[model samples]
Structure formats: structure tokens, C-alpha cells
Target: MKRSEFIGEFDLDAVLTELSVDLDIRVTRRMLAGACIGSNPEDAYLSARELRESLEWIHEGENEGKVKLTTILSTACDDFQRCLYYCVAGKGVVTMLDDLVWLEKLLEARGRIAGHIYRNKLPVKPLVNPYVAAEPDGPLGRFDPSFAIGASWSHDPGPDYDSDDRGPGPKLKG
Candidate 1:
């Protein structure tokens, strides 16, 4: 099929089917928002709108055999990496090195969560970011803000750096 024709059929459902292992509307939305590109503002807006509608459809329990959000996201990350590999191998457009770094971090975080879940077998509650507040009447109605946000996890001597002390050199810029 022609690229234009293929793209035309690549709707949200198609994307979800491609990326989803187990998915939910709200979580699916949150994932997409994190993955949204800012290079084209209009495209971002349209993408969000489309994603919202698509997720709503799933939220209403329209899609059959849907899986868990984490699984879906894990599969998505894998699929994204595969696509990147294909792009490079096929001499197609490749994502920026910074984007690759970010993706690598995402993959690592996902792997950690998957490993933790596999080891624990406990219910892993989704920590909805305060910035992207979940609707009270939405699918994820019960808000679970148990996780920390914007906190530095590094051991760097923050704000206490002494010029003469030479503390592990300058810390990497976030």
C-alpha cells in the first residue's frame, strides 16, 4: 500500500491495537500525552483529541479482550524501539539522539516496573500525576497520588557545592 493510504488507515484504534497489550482509556491517554510531540502544536492538539475519543470508546468497554495498562505500555515501548530499529535499517527518518536517550530511560523505567511487579505479584496502583489530574467521574475515578514528583533521585551535592571542595565535578544538568 502507498504510504499515504497506509497512514490514512493508521487511526487511534489501529495504533492501540499495535501498541496495546492490555490497555485502559485514562492510562492510554496518559501514556499518549507523555509520548506527544511538540514540534507541531496543531498535530499535538489533534492527536490528543483523537486519543481522547479513542480511549473513551475503550473506557465505555467497547473494545473486547483489552489488557492491563502497564502491559500495553510495555508492549508500546518495545514496539517503538522496534520501529526505530526499522527506520534506521530501512534508511528512513530516525528520531533525535535526545529522543533516543529519553526512550532508553522510559524503557529502563518500564523494565524496572515489570520486574518489580513480576517479583511481587501485588497490585501496582497507577500514580496519576497531579499535573494531569484524572477526572473524578472518569474511568480511573479513585485518584492515587502516592508517588513523588520532580524530586531529584541523585546523590549530587545540590545547592551545597563548594568551589574549593571540588565535589565530584559539576553535576550533570537535568
Candidate 2:
């Protein structure tokens, strides 16, 4: 599946709820909001730190059939990275570098979670069009023409067309 399709199909809140149920980890929107919009730098740092530690704990446990947990942690890591962007936007780059360092640690933790999933051979359902065959080299190999909007057809000039800088005109059939 295309990356855009995968992103559009994945539901972060649903995955978070599934992870919370499977791993018994309480991940709340409030915690995420605190990480994203803390009152001060220290508070933001603390929130990110706590979230990262929680991810580490989750990674250490057996997550055989918890593919949703992996997705949740990956989403959390992306949220933390976005928070760093906000930090850089508000504060100078020099100060935000410290946060960048912390973000790297969080990324590493996320990688470990991914590694656990890969190692356990977890079943990740692919988001695909049921009408299309599931073969990689089949009809799905080509981009769906329906996705093309406002595509210019000027490049395709039919035979017997005069090219005197007029370009291709719309063709009509009787």
C-alpha cells in the first residue's frame, strides 16, 4: 500500500485505545496535550520524558499480537517530534537542540518497539482495495488514473496536427 493510503487509513485514537487495553498502559490525550503545549520548557521536557519512559516500558514487555501498540508508540513519537518543531519555532535553535537530543532518544525507543514487532512476526493487516488483486505486480502496480485531477493532456497531440506554437486543441468526434 502507498504511504499516503496507509496514513489515511490508520486511526491513532483507535490504536491508542487498543494499546491501552492490551498493554494496560494509560495513554491520555491530556498527556499528549501537555507534551505538545506545556506551560514552560521544563514541563514540556518532563512530559516528553515521561512519555518516552512509558514507551520503553511497553517495549520491554511481550507484545506478540499488539500491532496496534506499535502504531500508537510510533504516533506518539511523531507527536513528540512535532512538539520539538513547535519548540524551535518559539525558542531559538540553540535551546531547542537539547530537546532535539531528547527527541532522538524517543526515536530510538520507537525503533526498539518496531524491532519488537518485526521480531515477533506480528500480523499487520494491509490497507488495500478489495476490488484489486493483492498481487504487488498486478493491477495495483499502476497508479489509479482516477486519482489524477486537472491533468493536462496538451502533451498528447494526434497525428496530422500542425505544431505552429498553437499547441494541442481539444478534439471533438462526430
Candidate 3:
């Protein structure tokens, strides 16, 4: 199945939510960010290792009655493992590098599938700046420019202003 189709078929958000609620563990964006690793062989190895370790940790917690795992959670974990497997082989070497032509293809596929699962599944909200007002819609908002004023200075030069003045007041002595 296509990567998007595969992602759509599984309710990853529900699985993660179920795990978090049952385990009473907070799953923040930072935790799920680990899934984005694997740019290189070593990174991919580490990412897979981390996922495996996480699964083992969860299993241990389940066994100790500290956490609970439903079938869906288990399946989701297994799917993640499979996704990691495609990026690097058992010995931590990329599988398709021998044929340089196909390496890019493999990497692209791996990234697309894993990225969709990791990024699209997470419950992360975009951070908003409270001090700034959101731009309105339409061309006016799009064309508007923002400016920062350091200090206010009067262009009129008050009552002492002269239209043909060569300088503003007298130059300060050093």
C-alpha cells in the first residue's frame, strides 16, 4: 500500500492516546520527535534502537502492572518497528547502498512512510506568540509590512523648526 494510504488506514493518534491514558505517562512532542531520526546509517541504527528500547520498556511496565497495552498499541509498535527496519538492516548497514542508484529510492520511501507516521500522528500544536496579533486574511494582510520603532523623534523639530535648515539644532561636541 502507498505510504499515505497506510497511514490513513491506521488510527495512530488513537493508539498513542490509549497508551498514554492507560499508562498514565505523558507523551509529549519531544518523546515522539525521536521517530524523526535516521538521516544516516548510525542515526537510523540509534533510532531503531530507541524504538526497540521503548517497546521493551513498555512491555516491562505492562508486565509489572504499571501500564497496560491493548492490541492496537502493540500493533502500532510493531508497525513502527517495521518502518525502522526498512531504513537500516540488522547489522546497522543500509540495505540498498550496494546499488547506488536505488539507495535514493529506498531512502525516499523510508522517509515518506516513517515521516508520515511520526509527524502526522503526533498531537503537537503549533506554538503561537501571545504578543503578536495574527494577520488578517486577504490581500491587505498579505501586503501589510511590520516595522519596529526604536525611539520616537519629531520630524517637525517642534516650534524651533526651520524648513530650509541645513542641520537639526547644533552638533554636539565630543
Candidate 4:
């Protein structure tokens, strides 16, 4: 994506395809911003196409869940709008955490996914594996792993999450 364009302009598929070539890292639609909840229409559509190109990746297991946030630059509809996006990643796949109300009410999705940000970054660990659950191999190629297969996974949501003296990272309430 160009520095001048809004996130809403491009689809996630297109960006991921271009990004895969540019970053040398495989990007799945599950992580693309527009493909999930509260997504920009354009970005979501583009993501589908990008996913079609690279169809041979598998999910990697994890002790904690991870989600890939698509840079909010493309999802912003206005030229001057900029925002942070949240997503779910685990089991080798990254997708939108649409169910979380954080984005709907203009809240942060990090705390909802994890308990708090007491540790530098809030831990939004998933309870289960959320990977694509499949793979396609290329000649002389390898199958990449994925993450976060479904909504059943999560992080700790107990009293430890709400400690006031947790440090300098962003804090989240249960």
C-alpha cells in the first residue's frame, strides 16, 4: 500500500498478495482487516483473492494465542483518518476477532482477547488452536504453520489482570 492511500480503498487480498511478495512472509486472509468484523468493504474483498494465491500453509501450535492486526491505514474510509486494528492469530491463521465489542464501541480489542496489558503488551492468548487446518505443498517448497483456529481460545481474566502497579504498558480491565 502507498503511504498516500486509505485502508478502505484496497481489499485485504490484494494487500496480502502484494505484501507476501514485498515482505517475504506469508499473509493469510484470516488476518486481513476487511475480511472480518467491522471490516472495510474494499479490503475484505481483496483479501479473498490474495488468499487464493497462497493456499499451502498450516497452523503452528502455541502456548499463547496471537492475532495479526492489519495496519488500519487501508481500512480508514477518509483520507485523513488513521486507526489501530485488532485481530486474532493462533494455530497458524490470523482472522478478525469480530465478536469483541472493543471495536464496535470504539474500545480496544486487546484486553477483551487477553486479560490486561500489564506485561509490556497485553496478552490476548487463545485457549484453543485457530489455524486453517490444511496445507498445499509446492515443488521444492514447504508448508508454513498457522495459529488460532476458533473462538474457544483465550487469556487469563482474573484479578491479576487488573493490578494498578503493573508497570508502563497499556493496561486492561477484566
Scored by TM-score, the top model is 2
Ranking by lDDT: 2, 3, 1, 4
lDDT tens digits by residue: candidate 4, 1-174: 754353222222343234324322213222232334333333333443232212212123332212122222233232111212223223112222322221232222322322233343433222221223222122222212343334423332322133334469755322
Window of ten residues with lowest summed lDDT in model 2: 145-154
Estimate TM-scores for all models. 0.23, 0.25, 0.18, 0.18
Clashing pairs in 3: none
lDDT of 3 by residue, 3-62 (tens): 655443433233323432332221221122233332332333344454444334432433
Model 2 gets an lDDT of 0.34
- Clashes in each model (backbone N, CA, C under 3 Å)? 3, 0, 0, 39
The CA-based lDDT of model 1 is what?
Answer: 0.30
Q: Output the number of the lDDT-best candidate.
A: 2
Give all candidates' CA lDDT scores. 0.30, 0.34, 0.31, 0.28
**lDDT for residue 65 in candidate 4, whole number 0-100:** 18
Candidate 4 lDDT at 169 equals 70
After aligning candidate 3 to the native by TM-score, how far in Å is the CA of 39 from where it should be? 5.3
Instruction: Report the lDDT of model 3 for residue 58.
Output: 37
> How many Å off is the CA of 30 in candidate 1?
12
Better of 1 and 4 by TM-score: 1
